[model samples]
Target chain A: MSIDWQPFLLTLQLALATTLILFVIGIPLAAFLAFTRFRFKAIPEAIIGLPLVLPPSVLGFYLLLLLSPASVFGHWLDTWFNVRLLFTFWGLVAGSVIYSLPFMVQPVQAGLQSLPLSLRHASYTLGKSRWQTFIHVLLPNIKPSLITGIVLSFAHTIGEFGLVLMIGGNLPGKTQTASIAIYDEVESLNYATAHVYAAILLLFSFAILLLVYSIRKKLQGSITGL
Target chain B: MIRINITKQLRLAHENTQLSIGTTIPSNTITAIYGPSGAGKTTLLKILAGLVQPEQGAVEVNGRIWLDTARRVCLPPQQRSIGFVFQEYALFPHMTVQQNLQFAAGKNGDKSYIDKLLHLVKMEAFIHAKPSQLSGGQQQRIALIRALVRKPQLLLLDEPLSALDDAMRHELRTELYHIQQQLQITTLLVSHDISEVYTLASNLIHLEHGKVVFQGEPQQLFGAASLSSTLQLTGEVLQVIPDGAIYTVEVLTGKNIIRVTAGEHDIAKLQTGDKVCLFVKAYTIALKKMNG
Candidate 1:
């Protein structure tokens, strides 16, 4: 049996897009949650962190109901621009973001938490605004952790199956990612094709993980002058 | 030309905690806040630096209102032109020593000023080293100069030398005193070490449980009844038990045993038969008659 490479390319593209979007949204959100003391903070943190423990199907079900026509949010989205987020690439992206929420946040939180509070205080007392401190002092320090989160989220999104199945329904050329394609091949009794994708995915994930750990090691070494 | 005036009342019924800031740190003087832990030395420094908000208080630097809590006008710490060094030597661990100074300086491509700062701190050799890579003393130096790199209206150091060795700390204290004089930046330092106050402080603010017990010069503080009583004693070295964190220097005088915290240098020179004078405060003298 020959290998079909379309799904592989689509999966890589989907993973890259999800990683980029999560980076854009996750870093600042994590930074804020890790640093600030605000009223109702626990609520947003609980909501953001809800997906970490909830089964992918449960989160997917809620998202589905949320986007359904009967829901007020769905009506607002439609009224706003007739936007439908049930079975599109955007829907998949949305589901992946939620599914990989902890992957993005845990490392960032750990990064920020491990930072000495004195750094921020030093910057604050130097008459540098909170924004300036974050950009200049905080970001450089947490770069390794940020990279770890991005890489983990990207790889984990690539491997996500439950959320994609619930929200995307294996729609090829639209929402069907590599994991779905592999599942489809397995269900169709094409063991050889399944093995090809599975082997490729395994090798790719290992490669990514190796690359991440190596980079992280170098950062730690340089940081501590080892 | 730095002035601070604030009054904070903390009546816990079980424990009373009231803080009043009615003092002006003289220009170009390193005013030391000397007190035990939890005596609000850091709090006083924070209040002066505009990092803390008092219920009803105010702070004036150079005759400008930095915080007027009663009038409901308080500037955030970021807007206050003050240099601050935290106790933990909060240098950016991810940034190189050079980058840390440059970040504090807020320069785009200018490296000359950073070089000068590194030289000022005697850390020019470790410009490329990260904070984690540097020693505690080195980090403290970087932290000090990092605050000074901005050239603010006032400099505040919170137990900066507590985490350093004796030689480094003593050397840096001299360096800081000299720098504070040369730069003419009014400085405030918080420490529990009486020796540090003696060495670096021209004026002393002794805090006891969040209230100012004595606000005067170190010479006056040593002469005060409260400080002198607890700190003055007469004894000799009985035993030196090293517990790693600090050596318990037991001084024996007649039937009385006086134990005090001393550094390795003092501990090394002590012997069982050596007669010595222990000048401890009365409050610190625990009367138990060990030989009864």
Candidate 2:
């Protein structure tokens, strides 16, 4: 029994890709939640925040049902792009986005909520649109929170288990990630390889967590933080 | 012409409040809303800035109806060309002084104009400095110029000088006056600081419980007609009247009869409502401006 390096590299890529995608989508969503006020706002907030307390497998199971050909979203994507999501690498990204959305949102909501309301009002009086103000003013002010969200998302994706297992379906080299690889090693009684992969995941997640938290602390202190 | 006739129902302390403040705010002159705390002064300013909506009424500035509840024509703050200087300065802490001003200017202003604006507020030396690095006075200067760089049609200052010390306030008030004159922008200032209001406001709007109790020149409110429960009046003995402690005396150029506290001076002055000067502490006065 030997340690497989491919699974570790694959896990890194999956987490990186997931983190990047979460950033592209989550940052703007967070900006939206931070500013605009309309009727029934709490409903959308509760929906975005639902994943926080939800069971990972339940979330994965729902995604599985929703991504099937029977679902409207699934049929739309399949009709337009000829893509089947379940049991694939793309499926893992989809699951990761839902599973880790709160990790992306909570920090950002805190950042925006903590900011002085005066800045927003001042922006309004200066003749800037909500989008423009968020891009120009709110985003920069909440840099620490954004970075916190990004790094946390990356680390979280690396360490995640149930959702990825349910969605990625553990197709070796194609969809199987290091997390699954480590589990595979343990189940097959290859304790040596299991320990190796487990150690790397542990170290990687630990380092990312430390870096994110330390950077967030530095930002709080410096005030020169971007 | 800026015609503001707003009647709002606000729930300040959980009860619905009704307020009526009607004024043709003078163009290119500073109109300060002067009152005590919780007087709905800030609320009035917010309605004008489009940050707060009134239950009823409208704000017409430069012939554009910013808010009209009846017509349902409510223009957002971003659509109106007004500059608001928050009491805290509220400068974008992340951006440098220059970027703060640039953000205010939008797309039409260039770097040269920005440079000139920084120079106008005497913040050119710290143009690249972040707001966190500046002192209170310096930050205020940057905030003032940032609001001005946009060339807004109107300017709003909410306790704009309350953050600074005596010396800094003296200097900045001059700077504010100088800038407003240079830009010729109509302004509405809100401050509870009595001295600040008396020093700066060309016109005053006094509100109590969300209603306009007084609106007009500052000099008009300084006299003795509108005395409330809080302020007591003292005057030299105008008479030795038996009916109540009624003293008739001179107040700033007008003569009025007021209930007076009997003292030795009252017993010594010319009897039968004599001509003596009356003095009223500012805190005791509730005023309404007479039609000019």
Candidate 3:
């Protein structure tokens, strides 16, 4: 009769791991897409955003094939590192990162683009290296956007269902995230557990969104005080 | 010394124009680049800072080669030891005044130097204030010192005080001169304000239509008298009499005829009835008395 808390804890772990990985990869990608000019820029931009419009099942199907041990990428990983991604926790994380890529990239890239060109020019004229300028000047100036990207990516990864279901195969205590656990309860007509899982998710998501908005407000207030 | 010979094409008002500038600015002096809006003054500054590449040019600063098109050498702005105060006062909005100075001080620079610079502009109290919290004039003062914190070999200022009110502009103009003299940093200023140019520049380079119209001492280019001169008048030359190497020219002002003596080179261009502006220093103009 008691609710199994393992699914809920696993969900938070996956979300945290995916968000941290995105933070490391997203900032540089967003900077490159925001600042540089290239012939095929739109192609990569669209690919990053494909998860937003493509159905979760469709993306999950492709990732399943791509991460299967028989595939070249998956085979290389297994042979070289003795690793496997199929039906595993890391596989769920990989799925979550790809599905949440655009959520992390868009806000950060927009923030970087909106900054004044003179800021970069001034930094360069002062003899600062590109890395130094990005860290000291650009990153601090885009705090609000950085927070938005992180929050959205974390929340989106937590709420994901179809990608994890297909890639991780819904194994209990391993890939049975809160979303999948709730689905299983509903299918078996376990109304009480379903209600509990759904309520926790709704409240947690609302609290995260509220935190994001309040932080944004505080940042704006400090900007005006300056 | 800064020697520049560069050419770049610019699009102005939908017309193509070439900017060809060649000049050598002496060391330890302030040289003002005075020109109209579309005269390529800012472009020249960008080239000097290594922000813009010239199609065919060579820039030599203090015996170092910055840009040489023939040699296929062009150093990036980060490698050039120069300071540039952008027209917009490009202060980092996120950083406080002190943080801004520390950012420019670089890792090897002296951190205490920031306090000295802030003291010079009387901005010590606002060291913790962000740029957005300060007025336009205040931001400009920070921008100037931020550039100087590096002790740059060359300081390039593009209308640094243009955004300030007239009173502030006038006040900063004097402070700017004193600071330039105290540091003796080679400076290149681009401004449209004639008075500002006259007050600060030891040398003036006038640009028009992307060409150098005149390059000389400030007074010589303006045809204006020096501060030491007391009598200046616009008059018509009535006659020129030869007296050895000197010529006595008769100039008729409003009510009287004044005979001014000048060297033969000065009088050679003066013809009868030609309008001219005359400058006579107070000590040079003698007072005469008639028997009464």
Candidate 4:
């Protein structure tokens, strides 16, 4: 029995897309959480961090409701953009991004917050604009954290099960990811195919995680000159 | 002239206090702000550099109003062409020394000027190395040049050499004074070391408990009057003998006649029977004119 390649390929696509979107959105959000001094800043911060502790199924259920055509936002998107989010490939991506939000945000925010304030102050006093400082100074300094965030977000989205199932369901070649494919194969008593998918995912996830840990260790050593 | 009149409320560990500083720093002069820790010296520098906002204040630099709290005019740091050297040498760790200078140089700055600055500090060979690879003294040299890359109208130095060794500090102090004189950029330096302040600053502002306690020449604050209050002895110049370039002055401190070697500049105006105060600093004795 040969393993189906569609789900594995789709998993890669979904993870890549989600990670890319998160990279764009996470940097600004993490910067806001890291730098701003508003009184009620903790409210939005807690909201972004809620995914870390909340059950994936619970998050998936809300996302499902939010993406359904019955909802106002869902209806507006469908009416204006001719798109339906529920059970679509983009729906899987949307769910995965939310499910893996903390994986991307926490690391970047930690990196930004860890930097010395004088770094930015030095740039500012040199007549650099805020964006210039962020691009030239802040981003270069937080590279290790950026890598950690990207790797974790990509790996987390690839292995996600509950949130993807709730929103995207198990549609062949579109939304059915490798994790879901493995689950379906096992339930159908296709042990050979299930084992193949599981083994590949396990090895891939292990290697990716090992690479992240090694990179982080190397960065720490270089940073401390240890 | 850079005129600054600022008041800020500060919350200390136990009490709420106010930092009220009002002074005018003359253009093309190095004004040193001398104070102990927690005396708001750094805060004053930050306020002048536009890093910290004053509760109620107005800062006018060369007729340009940088900040006026009552008028709701506050230009951000990016708009102020001010060079600031932080105590920790806040160099961009990821960039090499050359890149660090290039980043601060912006578009209007040229490569030749960068090379010139690197040459001036004798750091040309290490320009390609990152800040972390360099020693503390090297990092400060890079930081100093990075600040000057913009040719800012005002330079604020917050104990820029506090991290170096004594030898490096003295060497850099002389370089700093020469650079300041050559550029004639109005500068404000914050230092706790009396010798460091006296060496570089022509004018001194003494801050204590967040208030300007004294503002005058460095000599007035650290000269004979202040030295006599510390470890100083009153003496009369009994005899002055010139030995080659050095002058050996014999001072009669009551019963004892203390022999002190003085520089030609210090002994030029001294003659027999002139009252003087001898103060020893760093194991070297120096004479100052005594007040009646």
lDDT of each: 0.82, 0.81, 0.91, 0.90
Model 2 Cα lDDT, one tens digit per residue, B89-113? 9999878887788888877877787
Per-residue lDDT of A108-221 in model 2, one digit per residue for the tens? 878988888898899988988887877777877888898989887888888788888877788898778888888887899988888888888888788887887887888876
Candidate 2 stretches greater than 4 Å from native:
A36-39, A68-81, A221-226, B110-116, B223-292
Interface RMSD of each: 1.6, 1.6, 1.2, 1.5
TM-score (C-alpha, index-matched) for candidate 3: 0.84
Scoring only chain A, what TM-score does candidate 3 earn?
A: 0.97
State the lDDT of candidate 1 residue by residue for A12-44, as single tens digits: 887888898888888888988897789777887
B40-117 per-residue lDDT for model 3 (tens digits): 999999999988887899999999999999999999999998999988998988888888998898777787888888
Q: What lDDT score goes with residue B77 in model 1?
A: 89
lDDT of 4 by residue, A1-226 (tens): 6567999899999999999999999999999999999899889889888988888899999988888889998998899998898999998888888888888999999999999999999999998888999999999888889999999999989889989899989999988999999999999998889999999999999999999899988886665445
Q: B133-193, model 4: which lDDT tens digit per residue?
A: 8988889989999999988999999999999998889889999998898889999999998
True contacts kept of 3: 0.76
Pick the winner on DockQ between candidates 1 and 3: 1
Question: What stretches of model 4 exceed 4 Å from their correct place?
Answer: A217-226, B226-292
Alpha carbon deviation, residue B227, candidate 4 (Å)? 7.6
Least lDDT summed over 10 consecutive residues: which range in candidate 2 chain B?
Answer: B246-255
